[model samples]
Target: MIARRKVLLGGAGLLALGTGSCAGRRMWLDREPKLPLGIDAQGRALWSNWSGLEHAYPASRAAPASEAELAMLLPKAQAPIRPVGAGHSFTALVPTQGTLLSLDRLEGVVSHQVITATVRAGTKLSALGPALAAAGQEMVCLPDINKQTLAGALSTGTHGTGKGITAIHGTVTALRLVLPDGSIAECSRDERPELFHAARVGLGSFGVLSEVTLQNRPLSRVKKVVRLVDTDWVLGQWPALASQHRNAEFLVLPFTGKSALITHDVTDEPVRPRGPDTDSQTLMDLKRLRDLFEFTPGLRRRAAQMAMKNLPEEVAVDEGWKLLSNERPDRFKEMEYHLPIEHQVEVLREVIARIERDAHGVFFPIEARIIAPDDAWLSPFYQRESGSVAVHAWYKEDHQWMFKLIEPLFREAGGRPHWGKLHSLCASDLAALYPMFKEANAVRRSVDPAGRMVNPFVAKIFG
Candidate 1:
């Protein structure tokens, strides 16, 4: 069966080689956004997010090497003191004309107990995996993309798929925060419990996180599997699929009737490293399909269906941390919402229908994952198991259609928007979704009376 599937995939690749080259020129002519320059007028450098959607020319950029230095700079620094990670967020979270703070200097493992590790907030997840492995431990879960800093991921409630595994902040036992007033506070369930819950997924609005203590476990190996299946069939099996695997998620290819089902399970097998990623090549192929047949949905769907049939499943065996995350090089703007687990399939079906009917220019696959609920006050998954659905648009494409067609469906299903993604919700809309909205705001005001850390974007959400 594997040999036959490989032959079919090889044939499809040869066909794509001939057709894509002929049509590549048209794809390039589709009004891609020009890359911005590094420096701006007045000699200040321009800072842009990974997606090139949000940018700013800050008056000052500071990278503090120690927690004491960060605390000293916070109170006296200019207003709108925004903290930046890898600039991976698509929202306006990091843009600031005042002060831009980077904690990259104060990074890495600080200390470790029996089953816990104290890591600096600036540590990136990509580096944290191997660092933790060296100590014979690993995190409970990690997001699909590992380029984000630990602080950035926790601030936004980033998560991975698993029935019992919660978001990254769910594993955090304690944290040290530098308030806008330059005072340092250590918070946990025992001391300052309100601050602990509210600041767990604080969106960098409460304060800048300095160090976090995570409750991790001994490192283990896992087997990763990837297969293509019919979208409708997989939707029917999603509940069972999620329950059966240790980690499971799926990507729905819009216009086409197929989906990619990926699963990771604990195993004692020998290590077999993941092969060179074909995700980028597959993405461009889908874009070529859109470019060639945007006006004709039937032809586009038929072509995609034919190309994906009988594709061999990809298999890999490695440490859980290594296989759970991936390298995402294609830049795009995204919006994701977490809804009640029962409402996921129904809402997803409607989103696909609308995208195919109204928005024909979109070619990026829709990602769906499951996350267990946690106690963090501002977390989107607070107190309810959730199924998250994310939609993406190539950086150059207009994403206004998401607000019109996709967002309403998610909102109608009692969904909460991701903090780091694009959304049009104001304070009132958010208050209706999160039960602890008022309490979280109260905590923020207590810590930042002058609103030194509040930017225009954050003000709109927290007001």
Candidate 2:
């Protein structure tokens, strides 16, 4: 955690004292956000996303235990049938006035071979790690958060960081999908190739995924290292850093002029297991700093720099899976876009400068990552190496600034928004960005002609 003692040192102590007067107001802002009623007037129960940014009271909820059960539910249960996983998505992809189907009961590893594993779509990445480890195998990559189910992660094109690594969907060799009209279609590069290409990152609109086959690697240990460095230095050195490490990513501390550079690589060193996570506490500390110095950028930057100045780097050696993903207890709304690799550094520079200049109430660190290209038709990283930039706001605060100030930059750089994150793009805008958009939509129509799987948000996206 950012050292609180160091933050209170010297002249910064006065600013901390001054904040006491506004305690009542700040407390109100810090309180849990007002929630929607548990039961809506229609008598439907509430279902909300992890960040509480999106919610709905589906007319019915169904958890299917097997492919047969899911196939039976899809055709006749309701129109606009939507499948939900861990509700990790910030967008309204899962909300529906009709049936809300869940795949939680359909979890676990189905089978495995030397370098591949077939898994139930509902298996959480958390459970998948150990299950795969038992077979001496592991996923080629994993996203930053592990709570999301296999289906959710793949559908949204969720990814991890590395120069050569692709997103989770890129590792998929085949999939079994339960279509809207009670038919099952098993697809891969050779069998039903069009469907496979279109639905790999289909955003749940193609159909509910039942099973997935992943090309995995032998389970191995990796060393993780994290250090704080000047933001400018990181910006200049990012390309080399990304190439040097097996997995590399960084968090830019807004207003602080510092960045946390995290890297991981295969190692034979003795296990030095990661300690309890201090990231959440450190995040809240950043929030406190924001509250205290919303108007005084200099002091906020100085105090943060002081606290972070001499802090020791954090290191751990563990199985790749355990160290690759993290626990994110603090809820926040996010907007992320994947851009052409060459424009990443220039875009990041603008993002940081813009946040520091105008988005004063922001305290969340900006995340930067790299993903190699994939053949998944709807994937943000499709056909080109990409670098991703994500911005966040506390769940209780307004995130409109991201759309207003940051999204334009992303769009102008020929970026594509992460399928499940916040974005304002419609069908036309997306068509221009994705070369295969029209063909993918045509494939979607062929499978679900009646549009039984389309929700309002999906409609806007697939028009």
Give lDDT per model, in order: 0.88, 0.90
lDDT tens readout by residue for model 2, 173-220: 999999998889999999999999999998998899999999999999
Residue 238's lDDT in candidate 1: 96
Residues 265-384, candidate 1: write the lDDT tens digits. 988989999887667667776777777667778877777777776777888999888888887777888999999999999999899999999998999989999999999999999999
Q: Model 2 off-target regions past 4 Å?
A: 1-18, 22-25
**What's the lDDT of the predicted structure labeled candidate 2?**
0.90
Colliding pairs, model 1: none
- Model 2 — TM-score against the truth? 0.97
Best by lDDT: 2
